[model samples]
Target chain A: MTNATQLPVTLGLRLLRGPAGAVLVMATIFVVATLAFFAINGREAVSLFQEMVMGAFGDSYSFSETLVKTAPILLTALAVALPARLGLISVGGEGQLYLGALFGTGAVLAAVDQPGWILMPLMLAGAMAGGALWGVIPGLLKTRLGVNETISTLLLNYVGILLVSFVVHGPWKNPNSLGWPATIEFPAGAIMPQFFDTRVHMGLVFGIVAAIILHILVTRSRWGLGLQVSRSNPRVGATAGISYERNVLIVMAVGGLLAGLAGIAEASVIQNRLQDGLASGYGMTGFLVAWLAGQHFLRIIPLSVLMGGLLASADSLQLYAQLPKASADILQALLFIIVLAVASLWGRRRDI
Target chain B: MEYFATELLTLLFAALRSATPVLAVVLGEAMTQRSGVINLGVEGQMLLGAMTGFAVASVTGDPWLGVMAACFAGIALSMVHAILVLGCGANQIASGVAVLILGGGLSAYYGTPFVGDKIDTLGNLNHTFVSDIPLLGQFLGPITPTVLITLLAIPAISIFLFRTRTGLRWRSTGESQDITRNLGHNPVHYQLAAIAFGGLMSGFAGAALAVDYTANWVEGMTAGRGLVAVGLVIVARWNPWYALPAALLFGASEALNLKLQSWGVNISPYLLATLPYMIPLSVLMLSYRGLRASGGGMPAGLSVVFQSAR
Candidate 1:
């Protein structure tokens, strides 16, 4: 985005150029809109606003939960950002995460009697494969059959969610639980390793490392150049031997694999079981975070954390404010719209 | 044999009842697509409409008023899309997704109070009328008018698209904004009108679900039917005439699932639930060549959605 929002004449806007300006514009709009929305409804708008902030980062426990939420968002964001480098709009992170959990849990169930040393790797591998499978289907469909990736991914999400629902309610229901619709608890060996005695797991490391590695690869490597070229001009990239179709599958697979890790992490470290609602819309949040960061991998790290806090806080808001948790989606949408509008306005200025 | 015969008789009417919302949404989405603007927010618009329809109908006790309110809500929501995509020259896909998020969030937030609430006028299924045929007259009587309007809409929309001047203008704008501009007509105005019309139909569809039959307000009630409409528009190859059969395909799967569950069938409901979603995917895959060969199924504007048009 251009530095047009921060002009001396536009200094009336109170934000300087770059990321800070964008954030300022988005935050101001979101805050005012949210406050006005609640105030118009005759609620204690100011206190509710404070409750939202405190709910997000107020104390140690809240902060940890925020980090736990951050892990999945971070991983899923990477899953989306990677394919976006090749100009693929993938909204399948939710489905991929579910598939990852599905496959990862399958491994756990298959080798329920195995020890951790052997079981851990198997579960992770299975999860990755499952996520990759979900990603690859859409990628393959797009490259081979010319299906719209957005619609394909969205449809796959429903199928993936129901697939989990079908298994848990039918074949995989824990026999001892009687009527409860969920699988057996994961054995300790299969659980993702936690950090600092908190719910933050190995998935966090995977996400951070993946983001850095992707940043290096995308910005510093010839393969990354191929992605950029292929995104901007597939014909040109093909002439340069980039093989756009091959790259599409690779990026999509790797993206799905990362999201799969997040799925297994959620099942193992947080929920401790393969169950329905395993994703809880983190995949959607991840997709939003990826887009919010302009599909830049490194930037996705902080954005995911910030978005995680928003989601984490929303949970708290539901507890205290008597509001539904989906309220956070409104703020997220507002941020996206505001950022998009400002960025476009900046781009328009640059054109002149 | 008796049970099977009884199920078969009502299944057609049930499928038509269920298909109404999807068919309406498909027609609207097709109108938007035909005008060269892809409104992925149809799903969100439907949800907002469903919520508003339920909320207003329950409070006002007037289903028509609720439906009108729902339509306005949808139009207002789509205006957000128009502003972002047209005024800001933003990426249409991102803008559409943003609108979806906004609609979903707002509906969820505001519709919280209306959960599990039902309006008396909407529960048409509870007050059944007995008939000599058992299923034919009884099943088709109350919903026949609704069914007629929905079915009639197919030809009505088709005539608008293929036989009217404005319809030609909308299709031409979808094909080429530049050529439309050269022809001294503003593509923006045409696309905006098409989007608003799509939103109106989406709202009407949602209201049909809320006040016309179910009357029970549930959170996120449309449940991806709007997305199915997106695929149906493509599967129908952007032709409103084909939308009915395509919508019925989805509606039949859903109706069959409900039937099977009621009959205590051994099949997992979740597995059956996957059928409707699978139709568009399979159709999209199998009919790829047909879609492209028949003068390109996707609008030229939609093909370049990621890029800034301005």
Candidate 2:
């Protein structure tokens, strides 16, 4: 009984000694600051907060919607989290996601008559391949050409989005859609299966499984240990015969695969086709989720759900509070800034 | 042949106009990078500046005042970046991305009110005395005051970088912070000053785009121009003088893209629109080997922030 009671106190003290304390403080500040903004605008702050909470988790429907949102965010967050382990800041997840959807749609369109089991896997493979190809470009550029991966990946995002726009507006426009720019909807066989009596699809299961597998692979496996070594000190890792270049390529591929999965899920399960809003800044939001989670695979699951709920509630802010949709964007950005500041402060204190 | 010549001249004028905003941003980022701090928040700063400038101009009926307001707004945001990156010793890349998001979100939120509002814009400089001259007059007649200022800024910044004593201190700080500190200079102060200047320039770029080029405000109007300017700094070998031609090259591509679209060409406008971004990527890739061999002209301490070693 003593051990059990003392365990929580010791664990809490340990968290305060590390990064968690700063994170908690920053989160508190973010909430207070947001409420202050609303108060300054002459709105009832308490009710607004209550409304947001209710909108996000008040009913089963909103909770289900939040879960639906979490699937894509989790995968995209993995895309950012994976490459971050390799010391590469790949902000091009948005581009890779678009390519994934494009390739998935193309695969489905090519084999419209195929059976469900065969077509689904093929679409997933094509999406992953497209994303991997996009992801590998930056990896290759960084390893071979000495170009900065950050800028190249970002520029490639614009290229990828433009490619999608071109195809949708030009060749892939559904002839019967009456001037709307979009591809033909996936056939019944091509669509993902949903849970009984809910909007949740197989993607949620995929995200959860991927998170668990990645957490184990990253924290418990030998390869994960090697990756940590290589990330922290490449020269030392190289001296120990670890191949730095191979890790870069492999890690980026895995990251792309995750993002690709998100893209295919959004296209086939949510929108049912590729369109202009297909990209939808999920990549950027995923990056935020990964950052908030401190790049921990296990942490990303819950953090993504929280972020997804916040985003879902942001839509209700428009209806209940009459705030603009961009209010959510502002909140997300503020949260990121505060977290960064707090983490930096924690880092500096540790140095002392 | 005559029609081609006229079209070419018009394209040149349009290119010069389009290049001014990029030049402003590239020159600002060039200076910031030269001080050993990479600020990736230029896009966000530009957006805020554009919105603030438009709002101020609409309210005050003074375009120059709007530009000044934009500059102040930029400095305010960059101050947040400076405090985070330099004061708190945060990761420059992450801090930059945060600033980018912060600037973008705030701009979008505030800009919602001014969406579709109009303001008096800066017009082109059509001096009769200048237009009286032959070929030179024709080249300069259609230029806006903002374009002329940007053109003048290239030579001015070049001289400041190469000939000024403070500029030497700034460059040395970027080369090696330890060396600069050993020489009794405060590297942090220099970096903060450089970043503030960057903010001012980015704000001016936004103002120029809003008041002179578009004469309107829109959400996310700066698009990726800020990132493009960051790339241009590398392509220009970190020299302010070289940034001129690089900016013009991008501007020219954008101008030609617009011209091609208007000419009823059969090519997809989306593909044509991609030429500006693709050109920079291809240029960076092709020049990689040369850049590596020549030591890439990057400052020695520029990437030191990424290293774990103090």
Candidate 3:
């Protein structure tokens, strides 16, 4: 983390002098290699980049789709980002997402014929409540019980997935469909309304609004300051008589609420029904997104959107390049790693 | 009742089969954590190892070679983490996550052709005479090769960690770096060796998944078992020997879920499937609570880098 000029300068050896320089070098290498790969394969790297931009925000139609994708990542990123501020690594967002989605879908299904006003609020509540409940488990364990949040949260993810899969396969199975593992499709009224003629639903707007509120909560509020103190030096905060236990629970609950709302966004806005695919790696990617952004709540919006584009472009890589969707997945992961490595190095030098 | 009994027995066998990968990884994690390094990249290492093992075995048609390849790949990937944590003094969590990302991508890149392709398995090695005794036989009924190997590994690791002087040194390294340094033994060396051992064990776990459990490699085939192994390590109090029973318990839950599915049960399959996954989380939570303060089981100064002056 030494300053760039602290060490003797040699053109070839510059990257080794400081952490930031090394990260810059790594990022340069990654971008260069990726473009070179497309080039060697006889594809236009520029065109691909252009397509990605178009796919992410080119037309009104695709722009809305990007919004649909960004909602979950935005909220889930908050789920990780908030806890990260408490020095607690809550990797259980995936599990919380599964639980939230399941509960949200279950609520909608129960009130399937209810009016849009009643059903919408109920669904959002269910999603948030479910996610919050799931979040509290790890929080309590870490704060009160002294459990390592990393392992606890991770294990919960598997549980959440298995639980969701079970429900989709068994009781929630669409009775009319032969053996397709999915919930019954939502009635038209139950689906969230699109904001304009575009595909972006109201959930994208909800995500943006949520981000603003979260920014205030993290940066300006008393609880936000308390969170900063806890993360930076929990012992100091504890000595100051700030209840670490209570703060941990509150922060996690807030994280859970955001993540759960993300699940609702998926159900009502994107998929319009709960399916087995409802909890697709959004939670995990949200972690990467948040981590890459250094877990700034406000920063998550752009990062999520950018990541949303990367995900949106993945479908095209499959269609046009005849590459498995997993290849694009690899690229997304590689970009995340590059960002994390760089951010960590940069973070060491910058005081948060 | 008869059907239920048979189903339970069948699941017992399946549980034994399914538990191998988890057993191997948890055992490896137990060793690493004992010396105060928590390698969160266990999943990444296992995936790389499994993919490597599968690709190598498929190419060479030698199960032994595949096993060796898996071990080598696992050790190689773990060393990358060692360099970051032990050499550069990076955060263990961050380093582990980085290695995981790398392992996952590497596996996906190399595992393209082998995805869904079945391979020649090591096959079952059920000792008929030993397995024929009434109730005792039922316990040994579904002894796959991996299961047998894992069972043997438990006690052997226990003896190695407790009975040997090297084991004591390894324990001291994990317990306190200062004590080990005071004793004139390099803690980083012990940490590296422990991590290397972990890589081999987790690799074997990955290999078992490809060759025995599924007989085919899938993208991210090791799934979250590596994380569960880490959970199991903490839940078991870093006891290598205890990992077997813990893994079996997890395997049994999975076996139950599979059996119920096979029987066309009407219950939510997700809830049933959740049985195994919940165990580790619950265990981590409970253990974390029981241990209270005292930094739980993590090694002191685990994330710090060491530079010996020449």
Candidate 4:
């Protein structure tokens, strides 16, 4: 099968049956089909390709936007990753993101006169606290009340969105900004300073650092082992004298905290004010990313950046290719379809 | 007392409308789940069915044809999920999510042209002969045809799931695939049939949303109603019969939100909108007792892969 003549079929089969096949096939199709379109349009395909490459990583300015895009995805991915380690599906990150951004921005606005150091940390903490509370409620419901975490968390996301929408459009609406449901800006000092002469802020640093810390926490710590045991089999972990309840709570809190911080990063660093679109679809996009990358913290960083780059390039695609803004979303969906189709073929020789 | 009566009556109709879609999908899902397969693509299937139903109905100016389109559209969507999850043996959750994404994006793309275009709605069944009859006729008269059809379907589905040979085999497969094989029934065929049933119901549900309810298509209009239906199934403990009241509870909440909003309530519409989700959350939380042991008669391999004997 590995011989020269059979290489294409073998590779195709392998691609269909492995983790990397979906992205590989999608990228191949995208490159070929898009280049074909460019050729038909009498355009220079190489220049079009170069424009995408440059838009993503042409210089420090573009690279920084990549990091900025990655920040929310990274934290939202953690929102899934942490719960997943305990066999829980925390799909509520979207809702958590909204709540975190809402309250975090609210805290900062309320403390507008305060100095940066105090207000920033306070707002960030508030965001984390809000998200953690939201996540924990579902965990508690699942553990104590026997509720399904998946539905609880999923519903919570909608609730959070509505709650945030109400507050932003009502109490938190900036009095000065005629009817736009937005929070007052944080004090200038409260904003994370730009990393260079770019809009990128320390939030990216927080994301990267959190990824490293999470890697250590999950791979090297006793808590990590306990979570692994619980995820593998809750019955066995309970028998091992490890508190499965505690594990669930811890995982939910960690997931929520990470997602909440992502909200803070967006509010204080990226958007600088809370509004209806603050969270966007970051939560849902992060779920796909986390699921695609096997939910590993370290792997999430690069994968998220890749997705972020694709999203960032959507602007360029719209301008150059006349694609709709939603085109990038379609591409992401295609990637997921291809990836899942490819990955599911592994170890299929045996029956369930 | 008068206020309470009016609220209750208003909620009754509202619950019927809201519950109609959930009931449609849950009945279909209940059948599939009984046959030892889980179709997590209910959400996507409903979305596809909804958009197709609306588009076909609006274009043809016929609600029934629109509904037929919904069923076919839903079945087409389910086939993809059935292929990936049942045929290729992919992870059900992952494949379901993929289908959901596909359904959302596909519908949005096609539905863009039809946005805000309202069609003649499916009219009420309030005939003077039936409607003039005392209280019972009055209650059933103003009801939509979709709700009447769904109410009729409940008993028919219950009979199909419990009183039939196929139903027994389906139950056996979900309970124990080994027993099913020994009994000489192919589980995959049963699963496929069950999923197709779910697709049809989802399509009907979607059609009801656009043709009967909204009279137009909107991007992501099904909202999380599909997920709510799944939750209702669990809340009903996979019983085809119990899904009625459970779906009705959710519907009533939504209807109340509409009624309140119309009456010029100063409260945020978002908060009122929260009731539908919150009620389900409360139900799931309250019903958590003794769920860990047997899962309220959930199929043993409801979401598991079944390997057939060669």
Candidate 5:
């Protein structure tokens, strides 16, 4: 893709545009957009923007909620960026996430009596396998069958979501819930370990560690160099003894594995039950973050945190101001648009 | 035997109703992709249309106004895609995804008030002459205005694409910018127009779903149909004519799912819902080679767009 050789451009953007200017642009645009949006809706719109910030980081408790949302987004962004490094646009992170939860929940149910040591490993493995399975299908389809990875992965998303819905609504419905579509509440041993008695769990650690390792592998390793070679010119890479097919499958599977981890983490730690609408738009959010960071792994970390804060703030806006919960989504989309437009314009001016 | 035929005819009619929104999007997508622009954000655009259409219709009590509003909403979003992709040289896929998120977010935000709201949906034309006929007549009975327009859209788009000079030039942009440039036309103009057209059709689709077919409002009601239309457009080999069959196929699956629910069958509603997606997927897999070799390959520019990261 034309975006792979964009590191130099990204670096130029960061340096030439200046960090302060960039933040100001984001803040000004966000303020105008959100204020206008609320004003059009006939809301008071006064000081709502400041409340949004406070909602995300007003106190220790609010900040912890932001971190909670950040974990899944961070992992999913890495999932997208990995395949993106291979010049493959895989939008299947949402599906992979649902598969992870489905598989992880299944493991927990099967071993309801098991202790933490046995259950955690088994459940994590199951979730990873499920996510990997989703990723590998699209990879194999592209590699062997010459299908468009983008379209296939997208179509799989609906199927994956429904697959979970089918089970919870049918075979997996907790009998005690009396027609409510959900699995039984996860046992205590099955839950992800939280830190500092806060809702923030080990998923955040997993995401940060994964991002660091991915950055090292993608930017500093020989295998990562092979991925670049294959991405730029597969035939040339093949001549250099790099199997493009192998790299494609490897990136896709690993990407799916990471997303699956996010899914199970949400189910076990957050929802405490496998249910419908589990992790609804996180994958899309992650995909946007991956692109905004220009597919740079480490950069994805801060963007995910910022996005998480924005999302957390939206919940507060909904409760306090009676704004629709989708307000955050609008702001997020607007931010990406402003960023893209500015970057592209800057590059165009340089070209001229 | 006669009674069974009636059931089959009713199912066929139900299929077309379900196909209305998806079919509209497919026609527009076929044009957009032919012009070398891809709009994967159709899902979000449709949702916006659905919400706007439902909201406006419920307030104004006119489904026609709802349809127009939805169309404008779609065109508005598509313009955003065009500006980002064509003007600023943003990545087409990424810009599209952003638009999708934006459209989804905007629609969900706006549609929040209209959830569970109802409207007197656009009704079907029940000509007594058509109704008086046999099983097929009843199948043809109750054809809604949106379905008629969409049915006509199939041939209208087909003619516009295969018969018009402008359509040929639009397809040329997808093939090569140089060729289009040499032909004494700016490819960007074609792409911009095509994207707008796609957006307009997507809007009509959302209106059809909200005001014409279902006559109600529901969040995310278009489901994956926007994406489905995108896939089917490829399956149709970028030809609007083939969308008719694909639409019906989609309609059939949807109709079956609905009927199964009414029938209280043993199958899970969720699994039944999967049938619509799964069928298209199977067709996608089975037809990939045969369809590719049949010579209506993907737009040349689209493959390049996906490969070049920018």
Candidate 6:
């Protein structure tokens, strides 16, 4: 066949391959699981699903809310995707995000009298440092002590939250705010500026820029090539003079940096304070987004926005369908399970 | 000194009671890991079990039934894990996270109605014959049935692992799947069974927490106890016999934290609450070389399952 004629035929065959087939099956499974859950709850599945769709995409306000939510999700997803490239599993994004927010809040509180130009950069730097420190602990342990990064990161997540709780409940407790365990609010100057009269802030710009930068780094950089080699075969990579341990540390630091940026964005642009519920499963959701995008840095943007829309609709699920707030969690969980199953099946088929 | 002795005795009893649930979960994970699969879905499974146990106990007014429901719920969740990891050759770590999300979501979604609802909990066992025995009675007087079962499970699991033919088969499956397959034993089947059994124990642990330990239902009630149990398994070196002491140690830390808080210690309660998590991290780091030397008792076939597919 001619090159032009062969292209369409090959593309068609690829879609019929195992991975694509698995995706189709997973989509069906997600729909069925959603219906089953709604049925069990005694709600009409079709109507609730429709309401979810409308709630997420119905109006300009909802779209803006999704975009707002997407910024942090995108950043956190990058936190996961980067380390995953180096075959490291770092699920401590929740912890890293919290530490980032804590440090960001601390910087702003300390520099309340400073101008936005000076204070904002300091806050960002502090947040990134805090997250990097948290992330590096697991990386160091994994490389130096042979500690399992997965378990260590998971443990640190709880510890990080507890550390934050200790501060907010003790040293950082705002005397003016009645009884709620929270730090002082950021100075108005420290708050990030909104974009185009929408609630979406400068964080959205940061997320897009970061994603673009990471895409370039992953696709066009020597470090990225080294990372891939280490991930594929550590012994071979070592023979080829790639420093596997260094890659682990570097990837983890980069991952933490992204997650830290997410924390600063959420604290300054969204909540405007360091408080409990700051992480709120965003770290876990970011894992889902990264997995769904096959850990592709560029794909994280669209996938995060998609997940963000689903999360935004959760409020409407409570309002319109009378479902609990956890209804959204149920949907996300089902989608994640299906996607993982499909991906696994695809991997198996490729072996043949 | 006498007063201090009495306080220490009371703390020991509390630690024993608190350690029951962790004991169950760690033992279950030990069994799962022994069969060459790492199931990190324990936290999620425990949550689902806790919610289901509470709901069933309240609705049916039967604590035993609640325990059974929790077990089935755990098994159901673990089945998903098994299908993904064993059947489809999914990455065990990733599949585990997905299962955790599913379990957390399902429990939270369905648990809304049961929130704030109360039921007759499984209270302390009333063994009149044993309670009449002087000083020993004083020490064991407040023991609950679930705690007794957990204590019994330690020996039972140890015996099963070391003295049974099926146990050898399970161990071999984890050690070398190729050999097991050559011997006409399906390694995947053993892994599924182990995973299911693990789920059952996790369910019982959740039921114990809900119907025995706390006697209440709330969303995400298990907290991170399931994950803590996983760490405990590592500390115990995957031996159920060692798991008992490790679990008690964890329980002691928790009890000590509470005691300190009650005594109005100057430290932040949140910081003290972090002791359980921090201890495990420190233990892992300090014992890394020793653990590596011992191979952490991980099944040889277990680590390669994910890699081979990739």
List candidate 3 stretches off by more than 4 Å. A1-26, A33-64, A232-241, A343-352, B1-14, B127-142, B163-165, B259-266, B293-298, B301-310
Superposing all C-alpha atoms, what RMSD in Å does each candidate have to the true structure? 3.7, 2.6, 5.4, 4.4, 4.6, 2.5
lDDT tens digits, residues B6-29, model 1?
Answer: 678688678889889899899989
DockQ of each: 0.54, 0.55, 0.39, 0.39, 0.62, 0.58
Question: What's the residue-level lDDT of A330 in candidate 4?
Answer: 60
lDDT per residue (tens digit) for residues A1-352 in model 6: 4788899988888887856677788888988888888888788888887777777788998888888888888888888888899887778888888888888888988888999899989999888988888889998988887777888888888888888888888898899889998888888888888987887988778778988998899889988888888888888888999988988888888788878888888888777788877858888888889889988988889888888888988876677667788777778888987888788777776888
TM-score quality measure for candidate 1 = 0.93
Off by over 4 Å in 5: A1-24, A44-46, B1-4, B262-264, B291-295, B306-310
Candidate 2, superposed: residue stretches over 4 Å from native: A1-15, A239-241, B1-5, B305-310
Best by DockQ: 5
**Least lDDT summed over 10 consecutive residues: which range in candidate 2 chain A?**
A320-329
Worst 10 residues of 1 chain A by lDDT: A9-18
B128-228 in candidate 2: lDDT tens per residue? 67777876677677777789888898888889888998888899999988877988989998999999988998988998898778989998888788888
Instruction: Give the local distance difference test score of model 6.
Output: 0.84
Give the alpha carbon lDDT tens digit for every residue of B50-94 in model 5: 999999999998889999999999999988899999999998888
Which window of 10 residues has the lowest lDDT sum in candidate 2 chain B?
B301-310
Model 3 DockQ (Cα-based)? 0.39
TM-score for candidate 3: 0.86
lDDT of 6 by residue, B103-188 (tens): 88889888888888878877674477677787667777788888999889989988888899888888898898887898898988
Clashes of each: 0, 0, 4, 0, 8, 0
